[model samples]
Target: MGRWGPRLITLGVVIALVYPTLGDPPRDGFPLSTYPMFAVDRGPVTRVTTAVGRDADSDRVLLSPHLLAGTDEPIMAVRTARTAVSDGRSAEWCREVADRVARGPARVDGVETIEVVTETHEAAATLTSDAPPVSVALHATCPVSRR
Candidate 1:
């Protein structure tokens, strides 16, 4: 009975760990997990208003939104393209998206920089805001490896 006790406990622990993964897709699915590592410090996230405006002369679309970083101070903006880190075509797509965002208007006063840290085809951007140094992560899905 002594040996069996430990074995049963070990089995219980192993099952607890595997059960969560079995029921759902991995955390980084097409729709990523809400409980990401970076969202911890973002206090009271009020959804920013966004507008998709068209540049008639350039034939381009712009995405303008106001993001409120926890504090009253201005936050540093980080923009990423989906294809930049992954595949070549995706990188081009991401660049287009980034370009559109760059041209878009921002209501908040101090948006220091809009950097493309990683190209498309790679992981999403993990941005750290300046106001209170809050971290926000953007996630995207890619093919899972069989091997």
Candidate 2:
């Protein structure tokens, strides 16, 4: 019975961990989870996020997606960049991004500098060039690694 008790507890823990995978809402904290960040609906409002570079005159220059390490997951990519900016590691992140881009297939010979910008737009807003961004915030900027 003593040996059986430990095995039963182990089985119970396994079952609890796998229960969420069976249609339950993903969650984190107490026990463990897959960090259900997007488990709930976020509604129609969405913010378009991107990273770009600016010339010496501050003119915006669209950077290649390679800046995000060419990740297949856009949300994860943006979150990582934003976290880096918020954590005050934007300079290191910028260097890593620039290095990745230079080594990527985008043919960006070099990146002089970069910044992470986020623009909020209503999902139903007219997708026109002149619609104007509802809001634009500059998160971080850093000079790219020349190396």
Candidate 3:
């Protein structure tokens, strides 16, 4: 009976640890996967500015230029959008970029507004021009545990 008791406790502990991981959401839907790093083949310019704002509201705009290696032109840009709720600021930015890409090139006279909000920051912007399709490449920052 003593040996059985220890075995049961070990089993209980294992189940407790596994339960949380089993309930975790899929990685594909995660923000990290959604916002992938892009590789550009431009000139010496390794950084480009990006803006985010809403289609109707222009007062609250966010402009951020991320430092990227390997390109002169702004080959890739990240667009982050924030709402009053939801904790996924990075994912929202990626989603907005994807939506803009799907909508095709912006008109010379028209404006593409973007808005970003997070626990840390809020940004908005109105972008113009016919930008190319931004390609996103996903890389895992953390390694998977085998144990």
Candidate 4:
């Protein structure tokens, strides 16, 4: 191999590594990542669809991803909730969550009802400062049947 052989190989490797960065964020996926942390502009506020439990006093307890979608993956749970709301099946989803709360562990101890909702919030603010959502869209609500 000549001096140019190593140089050519290095150039080829560099090009290969950088090629995926050229694609748009949504398309920059598959075997290679688009690195949405750096590429996607999440903006200031984000709308998240989720399930929550409310006791008789109206205190809200954010349900876990498992209770929401029967999976521990948050993204999957979010997708499940979003799909249910868009498909006009939020009541069914709410009932599903309510049943989970009634039968699952004691974290949701006094929860009396389940609600499927979408809330618009500034990133991390709703959690860090305990800030309320800028807006809330209630998709469905149902009672928790304690057996």
Candidate 5:
């Protein structure tokens, strides 16, 4: 049984890793997740959330994962993009993200310009607030593509 035991364990591990990928839409978890940062809820509390775009009138415009990154991972992309921008490579990251946004099928419409900002909110408090955002840090901007 010793000889077969090791091989059986190896086969089981492989199956577990591949199982999530075998789904119709390819779910992620356990040993096959791309990354599982927020696999579970963190509970209600004050938190800072990063936002992707602002309109020409300087109004907040919501962005989806696919629109910002062409992937179902805005959090990961936001972290990477912020790092790139903060490291004095804003031009490069801006162009890359802008291109990805432009090529996305569900791109935000009617926005002539785009900027990344961070907003802080308290989850326990009421959603309505007359006060300004706790902070508004602009990280990058790109002109909307005419295409």
Candidate 6:
């Protein structure tokens, strides 16, 4: 009986672990879950609000999150960009990004203008290919001085 006690408890716990899966439309519970987030239908393409730098030679360069929001966190920069556009303050945000670029890495040295824009792209292609964006919605533009 003593030896069987632990085995029975183990068996019960295992059963409980998998019991949630037996439900027809599995509902989330104490630990394991079928949370609604998983059932969400997000598509392949996504529109992202961001900042871009235009070089003197007509080339567009994507700026980093640091230039956008003073942080390395991408989500924070996205929020900052989106908020600026939605609030009609994109010009101000664009200047901030331009300022950051002027003081940032050498790769942005030739950049003469900063643009706040929303770009749409296929998530998979963006990650795995050199494909161009599907669309770009420009919101604001500002100059970056050599200072």
- Best prediction by TM-score: 4
Candidate with top lDDT is 6
TM-score for candidate 5, please give it: 0.54
Tell me which of candidates 1 and 5 scores higher on lDDT: 5
**Can you give the TM-score per candidate against the true fold?**
0.24, 0.57, 0.21, 0.73, 0.54, 0.68
What is the descending lDDT order? Answer: 6, 4, 2, 5, 1, 3
Error of 6 at 131 (Å): 3.0
Better of 1 and 5 by TM-score: 5
RMSD of each: 14.9, 5.8, 18.1, 3.6, 7.8, 6.5
Off by over 4 Å in 4: 1-38
Comparing 5 with 6 on lDDT, the higher-scoring candidate is 6
Q: What lDDT tens digits, residue by residue, belong to model 2 across residues 47-140?
A: 7556776655766666654467466676677777777767877666776776665565534444466777777776566364446677888766
Better of 2 and 3 by lDDT: 2
lDDT of 6 by residue, 1-147 (tens): 799999999999888888877799777787875565567677999889989999999698988889889999998999999999999999999989998999999988988999889999987898899678899999998999875
Tens digits of per-residue lDDT for model 4, 50-74: 9999988999888888989998999
> Which scores greater on lDDT, model 4 or model 6?
6
**Model 5 regions more than 4 Å off:** 2-51, 105-107, 126-132
Indicate the TM-score of model 4: 0.73
Model 2 lDDT at residue 96: 73
Model 3, residue 86: distance off in Å is 6.8
Off by over 4 Å in 3: 24-147
- lDDT (Cα, 0-100) at 57 in candidate 3: 30
- Once superposed on the true structure, which residue ranges of model 6 sit more than 4 Å away at CA? 1-40
lDDT of 5 by residue, 1-147 (tens): 789999999999989877776777667676576354566686754444343655567776666766655578967767765676567776566666566656654546655566755555555453765545555667667776756
Worst 10 residues of 6 by lDDT: 32-41
C-alpha lDDT of residue 134 in model 2: 78
Q: On residues 29-74, what C-alpha lDDT tens digit does candidate 3 reach at each position?
A: 3322422234334542222234333333334333223311112334
